[model samples]
Target: MKKTTSFVSIGTIILLLFIHGCSGCKKEAQNLSDSPKKTFIGPFMNEDSILLYVQKQLECGPRNPGSNGHSSCKEFLINFLKTKADTAFLQTFSSMVYGRTYEMSNIVASFSPDKKDRILLCAHWDSRPFADEDETPSKRTLPILGANDGASGVAVLLEMARTLSISKPNIGIDIILFDGEDLGLSGDLNGFFQGSRFASKNYPLPKPKYGILLDLVGDKQAEFRYEPLSQQAHFVLVDNIWSIAKERGSPYFIHETGNSVSDDHVMLNEQGIRTINIIDVNLVGNISTNPRRTYWHTSRDILDNLSMQTMSDVGNVLLDFLFTTSDSVY
Candidate 1:
């Protein structure tokens, strides 16, 4: 994911105000319900299992396109998804970067394919080819391991898949691990989100009602805020997820709005898919006060810098949201 800008547009502020007003009305409507709230039971997410998935991805080395690690990791992810998902496959495409053509594949796994009501969960799986943000000038040309930027989100989704395999949700779920998300050079927006661009153009059958994207979610000091683009695309879905986090007393999901990001979700939204990004924007660009921001696109983004507890927090919120909410809620 790339930080497009630190400032929010005027239109976004107006939209946010409108949403806030509507939320008040919705709350009033909910208060009139005499029926008691239903308890949502979801499968437990094991932190140890999630960490192991991250470790296994790192074991394959940097997953940059045209590298051996890329090929091996692709095989590993596809095989693992096949074991758990009712239907799992790869969407292959080609892209030209820096005057060279490269082959890329987006790994997709579907649960309860027959169900028409569906939601999409996605994250980028490819590591950056160059550590452009590394403090050391010499290391800028080297590839990063992307323990938090890439592997973290994928790890959470893999764990979700494992649990979903054990206990199915009422609604259909689609997990897509988008490739080539970190291929862009500094400030080159066109080079990013190649896999998402292709996938959005050729959407899967039985399209999802809404989508959530996870990125940089494993940092020990991760703080997720409302991304403006997400709120603009589907403010109700964003409010619903955040409200769930608030109910669960999650410290990671902040109620305040954060910086806008140019990521895979942006590509999907452009294609008319209402997608929101759950990412730690503070750990990405210049506005961050967190010390871990140093690890962005750097060699320092290793397994040691990640926190299983942080990933579990985000994962649990997703589980609760998926299991508790009905199709009408979103």
Candidate 2:
């Protein structure tokens, strides 16, 4: 009887221990499920960091091609890019815009510059000189603040530069902040994309596998429709980005065709680099009134109009595409 009782007590102890061990395992598994999976290679884009970049650019004032703001912002960007990028290339050149000779610098920064396989990302850092789309005719003559039109895209790239500096992927990445892109008249294609045209004409070494140009991407109601030229240049590439946006549940990367924009990407494609423009062109500005996002080339393009969420959504989509893709983006 004593032996039987002793055996029963020992069995009960083992059962309790086993139950406790199983409970711990269940809790551990639950925690693992709750945490983000490590399979995604991209860094978590800091929206605050992105916001700071935008604010810094705007503080330099309207970055018109030859204004004091332009000179200060150029210095700021070159200094900033040097800190983040592995190798910085200052592509300085003289260009003629509106019958005036202006000196421009296209700042190109690279991560893993030695790698032959590369990807290019670019944006126009210059703001429009004319508020031609402003409601008041008098205001039309003044310059724009360019919080969204110029700073937003550059802010995204700066954040990406911060990301690459941290956990750089196996691929080579080149980021170019172009100058003199917004100095042209609307009807004339020849004058615009001056920095891009110059860079393309003298491409610093071989081109990347492909490139993405970001423009007007920081509106509170930002909507990135696929530009027609991007589809024409790289149909599969456009599809790939749109598909990634959908998969990531990004609210603003609408899977639709946007208006044909004669942006910096045109020069890159003409140079045979296979680049695409990711611009929010829903900006329907009338002769007088401005819609929510239709403030292009206007003084209304202020810092308040830019949204941190919008910037985060676009930046993350790009990061996921470049970092999480099973194959190369080419």
Per-model lDDT: 0.87, 0.82
lDDT of 2: 0.82
Enumerate clash totals for all models, in the order shown. 0, 0
> Model 2: how far is 220 from its true place, Å?
1.1
lDDT of 1: 0.87
Query: TM-score per candidate, in order?
Result: 0.87, 0.85
* Predictions: Cα RMSD each: 8.6, 11.7
Model 2, span 1-330: residue lDDT tens: 234336646765765666677986766545543443223556868999999999899999999888999999999898998998998868999987777998888988999898888888899998888898887999998999988888999999999999889977777889999998888777777888889999988997568888899998888877789899999988877887787677677778998887887789889898899988888877633322345566778778898888899988888888877776513556
- Among the numbered candidates, top lDDT falls to 1
Write candidate 1's Cα lDDT for 1-330 as tens digits.
Answer: 011111224434654665677886655544533222334466768999999999999999999998888999999999999999999999999999878888999999999999989999999999999999888999999999999989999999999999899988799999999999999988989899988998999985578998999999998878899999999999988987887777677788999999998899999999988899999997776357656567899889899888999998899889988876636555
